[model samples]
Target: MANVRQASWDGSPVYELENGTFLASLIPEIGSNAYRLRDKIAGRDVLRTPERPEELRASPGHYGVPLLLPPSRIRGASFPFNGRTYRFEPNTPDGHYIHGFVRMRPWRVVDTSADGDTASVTTEFRTADFPELAPQYPHDLTIRARTELNGASFVQTFSFRNGSDEPAPFGFGLHTWFLLDGEPERWTLKLPVSDIWELNEKLLATGSRLPLGRYEALNEGMNLEGQNMDMAFRIGDRPVEAVLSKPGYAIRYSANEPVTQWVVYTKGEARDTICIEPLTWTPDAPNLDAGPELTGMRAIAPGEELIVRTTLSIERE
Candidate 1:
C-alpha cells in the first residue's frame, strides 16, 4: 500500500505520496503545483523541477505544473465578457496577462488520503478571496483540483464553478514541464492535431487557422534536436493524446473533451525540458468574437460548474 504524507520543502509544506516504487510531491501553497514525480525503481524524474529553491521562488512557471486560468494571453490585459469588461495586470513584458492569477496564489487543502494503491490530495482556491485579483478579474469563482497517484501514473482533475449571479467566461489549462533524461536532440514527440493557431509577433492568437501541413511531424513523431518551437494547435472536440519518447522511457498524455487546444514550447538555450500544455481555449479567447467557436471558451452560468481531467502515464522500454 502507498502512503500519503505532508512534509516541508523549501519553507513550504509539501505532500508526498510514495509506494516504494514511485514518488510524487505536491506543493499546495504554491499554486497547488506538483513539483516532483519520479519512478523510484528506475531513478527517473518524470517532471522538471528547479535546481535551487531560489529559482523556484523567483520564477514558479519554469517548472512543474502551474494551473492557468483564462489560459494563455489576453490582448492588452483586458477583454469584454457578456456586457462587462474584465481587466488584468500585465504579467508579461509584452504587456499582456500571460497565465492568469491563480498560479502563484495559495490553495486550501481539502483532503489527503490513500486508498489501497492510490494516493490523492485535493485543493481548492476561491477567486473572491484575493484582494489583488478582485480588481482585475472581479468575478466570484472557485477552482478545485484533485491530484491522484495510482501506481506509476499521475492524474489531475480541475473543476471551475461560477458563483456570481451573472454568467462568466471560463478557460483553463496546465503548464507542465517534462524533464528529458537524455539529450534533447534524441527525443521524439507526436501530437494529434489538425490545425494550428496563427499568432502575432507577441504570441497572441490572430483569429486565423492554418493547416497542419508544415507541422506534419505531429502525426509521425519527429525528433526535437535543433528545433525551436512555441506554438499552439487546435484539437477540436476529439480526445487529445500526445506522446514524448526518449531512448529508455516514454510519456503518454491525454486530456478530456474540454481541452480543445494544445501548446508546445521548447526553445532557447534550455533544451533539457519541454512544456506540453493542454488548454480549454486558445489565446485571446475572450476577444475572439469573430470566431468564438475556434476559441473554445465556455460561459458558465451562476452556480454551474465545469470539470476537466488529464492523465499522464510513464513507461520504460
Candidate 2:
C-alpha cells in the first residue's frame, strides 16, 4: 500500500499521496493556504506566511486560492440566472460582504500524492446557504480542485458539475495571488488587451470600455511603493503577460486563453502582494446574459460536465 501522510498546514489536515502532489488543505485552518513551490536558491519569499488559513493563501499579502461564489461571498440576484441568493452565514466580519463562496465550508481530501506535490480536493455547496433566495434557486453541484506541481509552476484544474435535474447556477475560479515588493501602482502592466472595462461600485460589470492608454504596458509593474490598486482589464484572445520588477526581484507570468481578464488587486502594505487571478470567464459570467444573473448560464444536462483547464507559468529574473 502507498503511504498516505496526513499533516496540517493550518488546522486542516493536509493529505499527501504516493507522489509529490498535495491533494487538499481544508480552509480557515491549515488548508486555506495555497501550495508552496519555491526556487529555494534564490532566497525568494514563495512561502508567503507561516500562519494557517491566511498563510495558505497565494501570499501573506493576497487572498490566495479563493474558491469564489459557492462559499466565501454570494452575489445577490440579477439576470443571467434568477432566484433568492444565500448569505455565507456572515463568513467574515470585516465590514462589507464578500462575493459568492470562496472559503466558508470545510473541504474534503478525495485523493493525494505521497511526496505532497499533487492532489485533488472536492467541495460541495447548496443553494440553501443563500437562505433568502433558496426556494427559487434550487440546484445541486460539485466543485473539484485538482492541483499539480510541474517543475516550477503550479497548475490547478477546476471541474464543476451540475449534478441534478435543474441546471445548477454558479460561477467558479481559482484565486492565485502573488507577493509584490512595492506598491502595485508603481508597476507597469503588459497584457494582450486593447481596452479596459469600468465596474460599478458594487463590483459588477458596467459593459463600458476604457482605452488601455499608454502602451502594451500600463500602470502595472511600475514599482509604485505607496499606492494600491484593484482593477480588472479586458484582454484579447491571446495569452496575457504580467511583468513585475523591483530592485531585488523581477517576475513574469503567462497563461493561455479563457483567462483573458486579469483581476489585479493589491494593498499598500500588510505584506505587499498582488492577486492575478486566471478566470475562464468574467467575474460574473452568468450575470452578463439575460434573465437572472444566472441566465445564459450553461447547464450540465444532469450527467454532463463542465471542464475548465488553465495553466500558469512564472519565472524570476
Candidate 3:
C-alpha cells in the first residue's frame, strides 16, 4: 500500500509520499522541491537532505531537486528572445544571472492521492500569480510539477506552458543533489552522456562539443575516487539511463527527450554528494550563436507546452 499526506520537516510544511520500500518528501512552498527520498528497505537516503529548514532556505539549490528555469548561467544577466531582451537580477558572484529565481519561490499544491501501489502529489506555479515575476521575464508562463513514489522508484514530472501572448524562450533543469555512502572512493558512476561541452573559465558552455576522449570510461563505470568534475555533456533523445552505485546499492536515473544535456559535479577531496543534473539547454545557451540543435536553445510559442519526466530508482543488491 502507498500513502500521501502533509507532514512537517524541521518546522517546514511538506508533503510525504510513501510506499512500502521508499519514502519521498517535498515542500510545496519551496520550488515544489523534493528534498528527501529514502530507501526504507536499505535504511539509507537516496538524496542529500538539509539538516534543517534554515540550511535549505540559505541555499535552496544545493540540497534537493530544485527546478531551474532557463537553467544555468546566462551571460551579463540578460538575453535576447523574439527581438525583446529579457533580464534577471544578477544572482551569481560573477555578476551573472544563474539558474533563475524560480527555485526560491513558493508553489501551490493542487492535489495529493494514494493508490494501491503509488502515492503522488501535484503542485503548480504561474508567473501571473506572482506580481514580481512579470518584470523579470515579462512572459506569462506556468509550470505544473508532480512528484510520485511507486514501490522502489521516485519520479518527478514537470509540465511547462507558455501562457503569454507571444512566444517565450524556454529552458529547464533540476539541480539534484545525490547523497554518497561510505567513502567516496567506494562508489562508481555510469552516465549516458556521449560528448562533453567545452566550457570557459566561468563554467559556461563555449558553443562547442568535444568527444569523451579520456573520460570515455564514464560510459562504462568509473570510480569516484579523486575525481574532480563540474562538467556538462550531451545526451541522446532516446531514453538513456545513468547509474550511481556502491557495493550494496545503486541509484538509477533517467530522463527522456527534450532534455538534451546533463551536468555532472562532484568535489574532488571534499566529496560528500554528487549532482547529476538534467538540463534542457546548455549554460549560457541564449548567448550562444549556434543553432538550436547544437546549443539546445529554443523558444516555446504561446500556448505551446513542454513535458519532461525523470525518475530515480533504487536497486538493492
Clashes of each: 1, 61, 0
lDDT of 2 by residue, 86-189 (tens): 23333234433344443544455555553433333333444444445354445556656665554444556667666667656554445555665434454444
Compute the lDDT for candidate 2: 0.48
Candidate 2: segments with Cα more than 4 A from true spot: 1-4, 9-11, 15-37, 47-50, 54-62, 70-97, 114-137, 182-188, 215-227, 240-257, 268-271, 284-301
Per-model C-alpha lDDT, please?
Answer: 0.84, 0.48, 0.86
Question: Residue 154 of candidate 3: its Cα lDDT?
Answer: 88
Model 3 TM-score relative to the real fold = 0.96
Candidate number with the higher lDDT (1 or 2):
1
In model 3, where is the ten-residue run with the lowest total lDDT?
Answer: 233-242
Q: For this target, which candidate reaches the highest TM-score against the unseen true structure? A: 3
- TM-score of each candidate structure, all chains considered together: 0.95, 0.69, 0.96
Pairs with steric clashes in candidate 1 = 185-225
lDDT of 3 at 112: 91
Give residue 91's lDDT in candidate 2 (0 to 100). 29
The residue pairs that clash in candidate 3, if any, are none
Error of 1 at 272 (Å): 0.4
Ranking by TM-score: 3, 1, 2
